[model samples]
Target chain A: MPSEAQAAPDILSVELARIAQDIDSSFDLLLPVPDDPRRPLVEAMRYAAIGGGKRLRPLLLVATAEMHAVDRDTALRVACAIEAIHVYSLIHDDLPCMDDDDMRHGKPTVHRKFDEATAVLAGDALHAFAFEILSDPMTGGGDPFVRAELIYTLAMASGANGMAGGQMMDMMAESSRFDLPTVTRLQQLKTGALLGAAVEMGAILGRVVPEGRTHLRGFARDVGLAFQIADDLLDAEGDEVAAGKALRKDEAAGKETFLSLLGPQRARAQAEMLVEQAISHLASCGAEADILRALARYVVERDR
Target chain B: MPSEAQAAPDILSVELARIAQDIDSSFDLLLPVPDDPRRPLVEAMRYAAIGGGKRLRPLLLVATAEMHAVDRDTALRVACAIEAIHVYSLIHDDLPCMDDDDMRHGKPTVHRKFDEATAVLAGDALHAFAFEILSDPMTGGGDPFVRAELIYTLAMASGANGMAGGQMMDMMAESSRFDLPTVTRLQQLKTGALLGAAVEMGAILGRVVPEGRTHLRGFARDVGLAFQIADDLLDAEGDEVAAGKALRKDEAAGKETFLSLLGPQRARAQAEMLVEQAISHLASCGAEADILRALARYVVERDR
Candidate 1:
């Protein structure tokens, strides 16, 4: 293991790059080219899932699972499932009826490249495949109960009360004025739930006790908030080219986000505080949590 | 149990009505009124799932499970899970970006009653919840292995290889000319897969051996074809008011269907023959499969 005194950013960048590469390969193996006429659906799914994003969510899952000594392959499978959910959300969110964005990850959106109907079906299929991966004994190392629990947790995180609900809230916020607390709740549901789930899933795979899981959950909660605040800052002031999509979109749409509500200076201060709090939650884990600590800081510091 | 000599039509109607009522109650109990601002998601989900068309898919699952002496409650939960998936597909299928329908089951589609965004989110949440229910030991009964198996099966049935794949194929069909074999393949993937899964799920619940399950598979396959042919007949010749949606839409769009290719007389005869074959597949199943036999007849006869 690298020394704790090592430069955090260097460690984080290397780790992130490694995780992204691993996940890309795994997704390749997981989603193969179809021989059927509906090959376009698989193609769209592969396009949306592969070659994009920071793979932050899966990295968190992997990092936490590693701390618990979970097998790399088992943790990777769960990570891929969570990543699939994230990618599906992106595909649907970019639809004409939703955000209507033309670009994502510096590439054409799935709906832009493939027709609208194909995009919808691809997203839907990806969503279903996530559960398929989690419940299959091969993915979770022959533990039916573990697989079942993972399925339940993932479904809870992705269902009406979770990510989808958050998306609905985000849409509603476009027309309605939301205060800080409401926006915070929205962020928690939309983004935090899945982030928290990543940590909780790690703990589940690790077979951590309830008390241990609570600390990880707390860590994830702060990290999720910090991540969103950073995102808001990016949307408000970050370069569109660097972000790989339109920037200042929330402001353009007159939407209320943490940045709009808190302003730039205050939002920056708040994100820093959240990152510190997030790191504090992992205090009990000692050096094993160095990756998570680095990630908490990276969430607010990254350009993208 | 009813004797084989009983009028098939009466038996089917009664059985269908009973299953519909049971499913409606189960869905009501399953999907409670939410206490959040995102209550609208749940409301849309309930609206789409509760008051709907014939619960044919769930009925098939239940009927097959009953024939194998599976517990009523366990089978009902799986039936509800499948029904949730069916409802979700309908909601997404009727989206403005997809079918753009204004009405379904004599009521406004989810997008019409709620907003387009809510309809999408609701459908997505319903999709997630299907796996949630199947993977929960309490719902699929106390066996973790059973729950995992159910989740795996349901995911396969719903994902790219199944319903979503079929939807993509159907969309492609609108822009391309499909011969009879191609249309049959499309119908098989688009509709037959899930219908077949309903029977397969029941077999899984019954713990039927692979050889025994093959017979049921054959039964579901024929019934699925017969059901689609009846749908085509209804779309071509049935009253719009009776069908609760547009009629002759395939013809108006120049879409190839069983009726369009085979003609009304040939399509009707074909449906009748398929239904007979469907019932004949269950001949070894004895009096326990009377409900299924009635359902095969009902597939070609139902007006709506």
Candidate 2:
């Protein structure tokens, strides 16, 4: 197994596919539709949660957890929690009142497939489910302290101080002129926060102290910035069929993005530089962290 | 204080007023607006959370926590989390895509006051803040186990299998005819779950074992049902000026409610019976629980 992992040019893809399937199965068991009206809500959650996305957050979590040899199932549960929050945010962001995108994950967005009300409730339900998973009673023999930390970290990453706050800034970016520093801070909270949380949660699950996670934090920060830049590049130039959603909306909305601010070539160069810096943060990490290093490279390289 | 409590004919009123102020103060501190574009998101959260509602859930939580002699501040923090969830749900439920409410707390709903996106984000931020509070580092010097339990209970109560699920059932009631059993189940989930969670969280705080909480569970269940029935009654007959929001919409939407299912006379009698039964479940407790007993009575009696 070690030889194959070392020999594979893209171990990250292998792990990503595996984590995606595992996360989906975990959600399937977590969300069984009742034979009642509430079934539709569960269905909406399942529709948005299962069989979608790059599962990048979950893969990051799982990969980082491996650094400490944490239990696989426990790591998977936490991974699912991270991805659930990510999906929930996407569903809400895609709402007509927000980004108003009609498609996601190569399919109709939850509101488009169901209704706007269902989409709202489904997203809300998924948000609740993230906490529920983190604090599940059968929490894989998880230390209560670690579980609490996982929850707090995820909450801080997703709350007003984090992703949601970034979104508020994103909303304002359209009406207000923003310089590079403002955009940088906005992306840090918006996209970077949850990405940071994924690594932080994995570290917490592995019982790594805050002090011990310094390098991992650096890795996450750089990767998060790189990911956002790649996203802008995709929006500006990537194929819509592969991207699976509307593109150039930020340009149309006149929102300032790295691509618009730096131009395509400079933005791409910056993203590549960030990816290299992210990998360097893991230099002290052993070969076990190769997947995370690959993930950093993948952040700016993936089509979507 | 004991003498005043005994002499007061409406101690529930006193406690309600006290909790409202305390909860607002807690929210005020928990949500300080940052000097950034996200300030509006925090402002929206503060607007919805700071000075609205009866604060009944917080009161119920504090009263139940008092039974176990839990730390007062700790109980208050948990109470704020509960109220935060309640307020977040109300904001989302009042959205133009959902209930399309225009007024709340005798003022414009979050959507009307700010905008749909801000309201959505404020609600999402509050939702994250609830778990953030529960798993807070200071956390009242709380037992990590208890904190985990608190998070688990609240998440379960608010998620798809709980309040959100119940909301789905409610939405279906507008389009499909629901019988008494279906309506009962819906109310149990919709309004009952969070109320039950409030009591359960207080009990968890006091280290009350699940088995030992049977009576409290029973009390919460009865109070939740009676509260919904009373709400239905209010919709049919109470003053909108006092209620602070739209009413009779259930009737307008042709939704099935306890009042619609049982008629006004029968529903009033049923609600009263539930309140009595709710109080009866508290009979085993000492004078410390008198506040809870009064809360049962208040559930059906409150005009708003």
Alpha-carbon deviation at A74 in model 1, angstroms: 1.8
Model 2 chain A weakest lDDT span, ten residues long: A137-146
Please list the residue runs of candidate 2 whose C-alpha ends up more than 4 Å from where it truly belongs after superposition: A1-9, B1-9
lDDT of 1 by residue, A1-304 (tens): 4675464547788899999999999999999987867889999999999999999999999999999999988999999999999999999999888888999999999999998888888999999989888977797678887888888889989987789888878887888899999899899999999998999888889888767687898899999999999999888778888889877788778789999899899999999999999898887788889999999999999898
Give the Å shift of residue B181 in candidate 2.
Answer: 1.0
In candidate 1, stretches whose alpha carbon ends up further than 4 angstroms from where it belongs are A1-9, B1-9
Candidate 2 lDDT over A184-259, as tens digits, reads: 9999999999999999998988888899999999999999999999999999888889988888888999999898
Error of 2 at A267 (Å): 1.2
Model 2, CA-based lDDT: 0.92
* CAPRI grade of model 2: high
Best by TM-score: 2
lDDT of 1 by residue, B1-304 (tens): 4675464547677888888899999999988876766788888999999977888899999988888889888899999999999999999999878888998999999999998878878989999889878877696558887788778888988898788988888887777888899889888888898999899988888888767798899999999999999999988778888779867778777788888889999999999999989888887878899888988898888887
Indicate the residue-level lDDT of B154 in model 2.
95
